[model samples]
Target: MAKYKIWVVAAATLLLLAGCTSLPGTSSSSSSKATKKLQTTGKVTDSMYEGVIDNGQYKTSQTRGLTTQQSNTSFDVKSLESGLLKLSKEQFPTSKYVFQEGQSLKTAQAQKWLARKSKTNTEGLNPEDNGQKDPNKRNPIYLQQILEQDYLGEDGSMKGMSIGLGMNQVDYYTKEQYGATFETKISKAMMTQQGKQMANKVLSRMRQKKGLSDTIIVIGLYKQAPKDSLVGGTFFAYGVSKKGSTTIDSWHELNQENQVLPVVNDEKAINQDDATAFNSFKTQVETFFPNLSGVTAQTHYEEGVLAGMNITVNTQFYSETEIMSFTQYIATAADKYLPRNIPLDISITSAEGMQAYVGRASGSKGFTTHVFGSY
Candidate 1:
């Protein structure tokens, strides 16, 4: 309790959350010119944001429908943006590069490329339909949406670009006209191959555009989890187009995973050690608090090693004193039971709203606690 930092929010009704989400972009590709400034942070968290010139205005992504274009699950949508940034760090380090919403691809061209490549729409990146309604004969949509992130130098010029291709792990469609819906299970192997092919096509298309002939592009292949999944998907592979080149030099495999805590079945493909720690943490925190509704966690891993976790604690908040005490107890339990080396966020909620938040960054020894008095 002495070491843990506490931030008490005194709002009576509205507890404003801190993170700033990337704003939706316009359909037109318009450039902006101003003084170049870099956005810096102490540590990169799940909610890292670019420093904006003004809070009310942000540089818009050139393409529209960023939120509506992809899977229904918010997990993959966030995964698409954060996963691409994490993978892009290999090529574009944060020390020198500044983050910005992409301003190159237009919404019209993006829509055209996302469509199937048919006689009328030759610009489509997807394959032509085989004129068959059969699931086996019909090609599954490997590409769901395209995400672009621009990196600029200290001078505000585009030094590099990161692209995320939101691929489908399972394509849900109807067999007949307004008939029963069916699922087309997409394998990771097929996704990998198709993603690479599509990445190259995207690069080629970009190179054809003006002022992009010599830009460096990093592409990440993300396989989104099904809409019903509790956790988001991970990036499977990534590649870098060398400077002034349109094609990727080589593809590198990225092994990242997200597993829900308190694994229900023995058949799950997650780490048992992480499961044990997470379960133990859950038991330690919720064991005495019978009033707590439920505790769940989404564990993230990199190459089989436990990386970080996002946990949710549900309850009915009746008193602020109760919240303060409960938050401290959970923070203590988290410190003793959870992995101390990785970052973790614990969000306390109730039927009313978010009651409090507790978080610890990677490599940090203490947790920062926030109790929202609005509840």
Candidate 2:
């Protein structure tokens, strides 16, 4: 099954400046005579989101079926195991296979595979060679490069099958080259059948393993463009067998397009809730600082939970003291109006520079405000 985890977004910026250093008590003339030099600016702006309001209308939807669980009966372990042993002994005598009882690929192993594939795919493709015309358009790495070693059995047969499902490869290639207007209906139909056939083959082989009687086998597939490293499509298929059964009973294929929001009742309701919260926060900031030129509030969510709330205010001018006070006022308002557990990120930008407040959502109650920026 696909692993569920919180997603965090990080943004970084770089600034450069030129200046001349002067020693304390140094004469103005001597200071002016010194050579100019580049200097680093000590300014930082951090932002975080607070949780969403507890609106009864808002709910999470489970649309993606990339993970599944099932049981099967009549699973032919003897036949499957025999095939695997034969394949190991004759087809691939020097391969290694790894078996694990999880839906998603192991994090560390996946990273190592991705790193190696990235290096190989980008090899010799430099700006001078015309291969770097577009970094994002570089040639796609083969699936084998990413999952081969992980699925190779020590005896040379396959340990687990990893297949890319969804649109047929031919139709995918055709559409990429000629757009969707081309006649690929027949090819697409053929491709779908092929995907099922391939899935069945892998499922049959995996069922033959010693201890997979009543468990689900999840095989993940990632579809990428011919020359792109990013996965554009994802799919999952499983073979289900029941305990004490000799044959497989169910087969499932989950494509990205077929996913449904099974848990979330209405996405629009959640969006409206976020908009309402942001407007309320924005109004409070404006009321506190009438002279503010412009102000905006944004809300962020993770797995349908309020993760952070961010507010940015712009003014014609600002002082260090004023910025600090403004941040404190906003923090206070956040604690009073927003949820207690999330974080609040407030930024104030003016003609001079910028300042920011990064702390807990419940104002500055439990955490100290970390304010840093140029004057």
Candidate 2 has a TM-score of 0.33
TM-score list, all predictions: 0.85, 0.33
**Distance from true location, Cα of 155 in model 1, Å:** 0.9
Residues 86-123, candidate 2, lDDT per residue (tens digit)?
A: 22222222222222112233334333323212444432
Give the Cα RMSD of candidate 1. Answer: 6.8
Candidate 2 residue-pair clash tally: 27
Q: lDDT (0-100) at residue 241 of candidate 1?
A: 85
For all candidates in order, the CA lDDT equals: 0.70, 0.34
The number of the candidate with the highest TM-score is 1
Task: Please give the lDDT score at residue 170 for candidate 2.
Answer: 18
Which candidate has the top score in lDDT? Answer: 1
**Candidate 2: worst 10 consecutive residues by lDDT?**
1-10
Error of 1 at 277 (Å): 1.6
